[model samples]
Structure formats: C-alpha cells, structure tokens
Target: MTMTDSAPVAVTEAAAGPEPAGAARWVTTNDCRIVGRAFMAVSLVLGVGAAAVGVLTRVERLDPSAPDQILGGLNSWFQMWTLYRAAFVLLVVLPLFLGLAMAVVPGKLGADNLAFPRAAQASFWAWLIGSLIVVVSVFAGGGWGAMDGVTAAERDAMTLTLLGAGLVIVALLSGAVNLATTVISLRPAGMSLLQVPLFAWSMLVSAVVWLFTLPVAAANIVVVYADLRGRDPVAFGLPESPGIWGQLDWLVEQPAVYALAVPVLGIAGEIVPDRLGIRLDRRGAAASIIGLFGLLAVGGWSQDYFTAPADHRDELLYVGVGVAAVVVVLAFCGALADAARRGSVRLQEMPSSALAGSALAVVLLAGATFFGALRVIKPFELLERSTTTGVFNAVVAAALIGTAAGVWHWWPEILSRPPSESRGRLAVLLLLAGGVLLAASDVIAGFLGAGDRPFVGDYDSGAVGGLNAVAVAGSVLLVLGLIAAAAAVFETMRPDRPDGPGAGDAAAAGLLRGAGS
Candidate 1:
C-alpha cells in the first residue's frame, strides 16, 4: 500500500506493533519524528545555556564591582552580551521551531517521510554545528568585530562567524525546500491545500520567509568578516555606520519580535482548539498572520526594528509593524472568542495554552509600549535606547517558553509513546511573571534616565532604585523558570527515563479525558 494513506499509522507503528523487517538495519532511514526531536533537544539546551548567561549578567548588575571580578571587566561584558545575542538569535529559536516542523509536519501532512530525508539530516547537523561555532566565534572574535584593534584570534572569530552563518543558511535552505515539498506533494488521499494543520503551514511559510531574510544576513556576515580582516573598510563600512543598522535589523529578530511570532501564534491556534474542545473559527487567521509577518520582515512601514531601543530612535517613526502584528493577533483572538462563544472553552494554564497566552501578551505589550512611546515621549527627549533592554529580555524569555511548549505539545507523537508530566505548568507561570516584571522595570528605568549597561546607579531617594531592584527580582524568577523548564526537557531525554507509554497509559488516558472534555 502507498504510504500517504498509512502515514498516521506509520508514526505509531514503531511502538504500537512489531517492528518492520530489518528496521534496525535500515540505513537510509528518513524518520521525520526522530530528527525533529533531536533538533528540539539540542536547541532547548542552547537556549537554556544562553539564558543562564543572561542571569549572570543581571546578577553582576546587582553589585557594582561584580563585572570586574566575575565577568572579567567591561570588554568581556561586551563579549558576553554579544555571545548571548548571537546564541539567542542565530542559535536557538529558529532551529527549535524548525525541529518541531521536522517532527510534526509530516504526520500532519499525512506523508510517510520528508521529501528529502538526507537533506533534512544535513540541514540539522549544519545548523547544530554552525550555531555552536557561531556562538563560540563571538568569544574567539574577542569583541573586536564591532570594536577596534583586531588581533589574530579576533580575526579568526570574525571568519568563523561568517563561515558558521553561511553553513546555517545552507541548512535552512535545504530544510525549507524539503518541508515545502512535503506539504505540497505528500498529502493523504483526500487532504487538500487547506486541510494541513496551521502549525505545519506556518513552518512552510516561514521556510519561504527564510529564503528571503537569511541570505541577506549571510551577505552582511561576509561584509563584516572582510572589514575585520582589513580587506576593504570603506567597502564594508565601519562599526558605527548606518550599514551596521542593516546587519542588526536582521539579527534584531528577537527584539523585533515578529518573524517567529507567526508560527508561535499558529501554535496557539493548534493548542486552543484541542484543549478547549472547540473547532477553531480559523477564517483568515492563518493567512493574515502570514501577511503580517511579511510586512514585519520589511520593518513594518515606518518601523526599523521593534526589539532594540538604542538602535534607531533617531530616525524610526512609524508603528506600522507594531499595529499590524497586534491586529493580526487581535483578529486571531477575535476568532478564538467566536469559537468559544459557539463551543466549549475553558480557562487553561495547561502548558500549551499557557505558553500561547504568555507569548501573545509579551508581543502585545511590546507593541503597546512603542505605541505609547509615540504619545508620551519625544524622540529627542528619549533616554538611551539601551535602557530598553527589558523588551529584549522579555521577548527572548517568552520565545524560549514557547519553544518549550512546542516540545510538550508534540512530545507524545514525536516519541511514539506517552509522556511523563513534570513541572511544565510551573515553568510557564514563572516565565510569564518574570517577563512582565522584566519589561515593566526596564521600560520604566529607560524613561527615568537610566543609560544602557548601567548595572549600578543611585535611586535619588525615589522609585528608580526600587524599579532596578524589582528588575533583579524578575531576573531571579526568570532563572528559576528556565531551570524548571530544563528539568522537564531533560527528564524526557534520559535513557533510563520512566516515561514509557506502558507505565503511563493511565496518565495518558486521563490526559485524553481532559482534552476531550
């Protein structure tokens, strides 16, 4: 029999029945589920590792002399943040989402396997290794790419960043092609274009989006490498030039908070209907999200980058991207509301539902803050844009939690068995609380005349010091949330993990009862 009609059965076959003949010896295996889970595990670790660094940076701010003692002075602090950004932007989120694509899309599409399995494997390895190199290269480059007086090691750092990024692009391109092909060609007998899950559709669209955005980033990386090596300074432009803005505008995906927002919103679409026992009133929701993201990628009308405060406060004026992002979501919520009105809907802090809500809140708050900026503060009167550090922190934290949520949502299918419950609900709660506190404090401090990178300053006997203290508390909570998340993920990957379906059928059955209700 053809594979398309049997794709769903194929997924459970590895565990639900006796293995295929010589299944262990099958060398050309193109298992989408395994690759996806592998990608998810690796990306989650990278995310937690970066967050741990962020906690260190925040802790350093609590004590005035800590940077010098703990982080090796200001130059290294610069490198630390740079590495964190590189890891956060280039290393974790996209791959984590794509990993979900790898695992979930085929099953959703009723495909036997990805269209190009070898290529998908290549894509994963390239991204995994390249991201590792890209992050390490930030340290190797010694903060000199954006600084002066480059040394031999620093030059190597620049070269590695370019090489690693190039490889990542290669991986992305391969996966994009493979995924698009799977969705188009591999549907079961009766499935059509619109029948695919919104989650899978979003990933397919994001793959095409990658085709547009990442190559430009790769070119920028090459230009940067050439400049660091003294190849053509005038050709590449220097650190403080407008060209750097373009480079950052690309890397600024987190601070901008829209590119990955599409798939995440789609994730919410998938979760809500299942958990709430309602059919999604999904009219125009998927298409609108895709269109909004495209506009967002173009910097959203008059906006330059949404994530950073210091980068372009001088020239950026429009709230086009923010408004569109917000509207698409509000439209989505409106649809969800309609569904709830007609069908059963309940308030849920289930891991998936909570993640979707928290992520949407983070992005909405950011868009609102910028919209509020236009009304409250003039551009010239603005404090250092770096004071907007909280926006970046909250967005990163939310996205990380969303990635964790995807893992939880798909864990059963990806592993071909039932899953164990860990502290997922707690993890989601801690992250949401942390994000709100972080954003409020950072934005308030920025408005109150705090400069970027000011780890210590007096309160002037007012709320500034209090807000700073509150931000520190938020950072601590963020650390706790991440630790909780890491524990949940690691519990799944343990070779001796006790989460086997045989042991957990009762729990799984209970979960089914809950979702069905």
Candidate 2:
C-alpha cells in the first residue's frame, strides 16, 4: 500500500524557539521517551502516596474503630479517600497510559519521532501542572465531600481545581490530535489500516473518542465550575443520565468509564502474539471488535437515559444496551481466548504474560457477572446495586495489566534491555491477586448496598465487617504490587545499574524455577 500525503504540520518549534542551554535539555526535551518517562515518574510518586492514604482509608472501615481516629478524623478521612481516587484515575491511570502511548506509538507507526514532539511535551507539562493544581485542591478538601462546609477560600480553590481538570483534558486533547496525526500520516511501507499494530489501532480509536467527548467533558466542567461560582445550577443532564463517555460515572452505571478498557484490550491482543511468537488468530476479527467497541462506547452512553430501566426496555433500549455490554466484554475476551487456544502460550522469562493472563480472566469474570445479572434484574439496577464497583475494579485491574504488560513487552525494544524479570513477575501476580480479592469484597458489598468505592459510612459495614476486612487486605496488597511494579521499571532506568540480575533477582528466579514451570 502507498502512503498518502498528509497536510503540512504547523511545526511551531521547528524553527521558532530558542534552543535550551546545558542541563535544561533533560527536563525540556521533546524526545518522546524522555517526556513519556517523566509522565510515568510523576504518576508513580503520586500513586505510591495515594496507596498509603487509600490503605489508611480502607483500614478505617474495620469494626470497633473510633470514628474520630479513622485516618485523622472525618475531614481528613474524606480528603484521603477523595485524593486516593483522583490520584488513581487522573494521575496513575491516565499518565501511565499516555506515557506508554507516547513511548510506544511512534515505533508502532515505524516513525523515528512523534509528529508533534513538542506538542507531546506540551501535553506532559500541561497535564502535570494542571494535575498538580487539582491535587492541591483535592488535598485541601475541595472535593465532592467538601461541599457540606462552605468556606469562600475553599470554594475558590476548588473552582480553580475544576478549571485545572479542564486544562488537563485540553492537554490530553492536544496529545490525541498529535498521536492520531502521527499514526495516520507516518506509516511505513506496505502498512495499511488492518496491518497496523493493535495497540496503535486502539490508540487511534481512543483518540477519536477523546476528540468528540472531551469538549462535552469540558462543557460539563464549565457548568460545574459555574455552580461552584454560585451561578445557577447548569444541570446539563438529569442526575440519572450515564456519564459522558469515560468520565461520566456518578449518575449512571459505569460501563461508560470502562470505555478506556478498549485500548487495553488491544494492548493485550498485541501481547498474546508476541509472547506466543505466533501470528494473531483473528486479525480482522480483532479489528472489527475494536470498531464495534467504539460505536457502542458513544451510542450506549445514555442507555437508560433519564428514565428507569423498564422504561428503556419498553423503548428497546435494553437490547441495544445488552449488545453493547456483550461487545465490550466478549470481544476482547474472545480474542485473547482464541490466541491462547491457537498458540503454545507459557510462562517464559517475562512474567508480563502472567499479568496479561490474569487481566483476561478478570475481564471475562466481570463480563459474565454482568450477563448473569441481566437474567434476574435490569442491567442498570444490577450495576447500581453493588456490581458496579466490583466490575469497575476488575476492569481497572485489566487495564493495569494491559499497561504494565505493554511496557514490559516493549521494554527491550524501547530501552534496549530488560528489567528485573523475577521482581516484575512477582509484582504482576500480587496485583492480580489483589484485584481478585478486592473484586470478591465488592461482590459481597453488592449484597449489602450500592455505590462506587464508598468509604466507611457509604455502606453498612456493621453487617459486612469481615468482607470489608478482606477488601482492606486487598487494598494493601494492591498498593504493594504497584510499588513493586514501579520499583522494577525505575530500577531499569537508573544510571549505573548492572545489566545482569542481582542477588535478590537471582534468588527470586531460583525460587520460581523450583516452584514450577
């Protein structure tokens, strides 16, 4: 296939800016790898901090604890919980995914540099500065739970914080355009649409979604910012409406948020073939699934709309909703299953395979649970009751798997070396185990009540204290897993580390060898 000519890029910095002098290169450099690494580094630091706070929040839920002493009283407790989630979604989830894309997508398109390297850098800085502002705001108790108390200063800070969020999305918007243009215009010889890497294809689709939905997100943020500024409540949609694409989770069930999981599905698709050293079982089918996912993503946003499930079902919304859910869940699961079945998949030196395998398991289980719920109750109620958090956590786990595994799989290609294999595997397993335990606890909570990651008072922990304890343990394990994963990756990037495995690495390897294949 011949490549088509794309319109001229603006190239704003190509000849316009003063060159950086001396040590500023490392920080201000537009090299995709450097920028990507910076993004992940900031995310890692914040994720570790969030984990500590999150564990404390979860621990507070244990029975017989003094309410005042639960993570430094109620205010701080709420702050910690709010910050924990913000860090997870905005910092950890987003930056990690963006970093991987910036680092990997260029090579996927057979290009030497991103189409807008400087724009990628801008995306990094904008997101960083904006994220920092929001982090400050949330930590200052400018979050959802902070509304009960009215302080002029706090409210103003939160308004800035929401604007910061809008700015962050704007930065991401720039990245989406940069990446999409790069992939579209820079493919190497004979590369056509179907011939592109699954990750690259998924990123393109995700970028397109961002283009349409981000403006809506920004408008919603504007309305919220207006409300915070004491303007009339610009209630754009009813509280019962589905979240706008991925960001809308509060009002309706959160399958929309799982839209982020589509690219993750593509990442896993790429990993399976590389690990197995074979061709993908159904390349066209996988591509078709991705397209189906994209359509379902936007179309299914308000599956139940402003009304109840029964009303939607009467309008035939139930069938469409079911189809969308099944596509999102079954499409990727089926692809992975097909690959594994056709290939001699095994645990090799890299444990990322294990991580990807675990991811597929959780996604399948989560999807099956939804289908089972469909038989007994309305899909909306099923998700609203308790299954939402459990399923969301599982899908998040799968996304984590996709991100970590993609990094691990492409590390040698990108970094020209391998990381601590044994340590990485341990981290992957810990995360998977943590995800399973946490999902189970959420399922138990579903029998108790409904909401997304509510704190001590959100649900009746008195009746389900044991289940809550399991969840606490799960949180601890999950955080430790993230710490381990971060350490392995960062250790590889250190300046003077030896190429070979160390004593701890050797011992871990031997332990694994002795345990089994």
Tell me the TM-score of each prediction against the true structure.
0.79, 0.80
In the range 348-452, model 2's lDDT, one tens digit per residue, is 644454345445543744453364245225444454444555655565565666666766666643342356667667777777777677777766667676344
Model 2 CA deviation exceeding 4 Å by range: 1-23, 63-68, 72-76, 145-147, 230-253, 299-319, 346-380, 413-416, 450-463, 495-517
Q: What residue runs in model 1 are displaced by over 4 Å at the alpha carbon?
A: 1-29, 63-67, 141-150, 188-195, 230-246, 253-256, 300-318, 346-384, 416-422, 452-465, 494-517
On TM-score, the leading prediction is: 2
- The best candidate by lDDT is 2
Model 2, residue 232: C-alpha shift (Å) = 8.4
- lDDT measured at residue 172 in model 2 versus the true structure, 0 to 100: 78
lDDT of 1 by residue, 104-217 (tens): 788777776898888887788788888777777766654324432445556566667667777876787777788888887887778665667877766766676666666666
What's the lDDT for candidate 2?
0.63
Clashes of each: 4, 1
lDDT of candidate 1 at residue 461, scale 0 to 100: 27
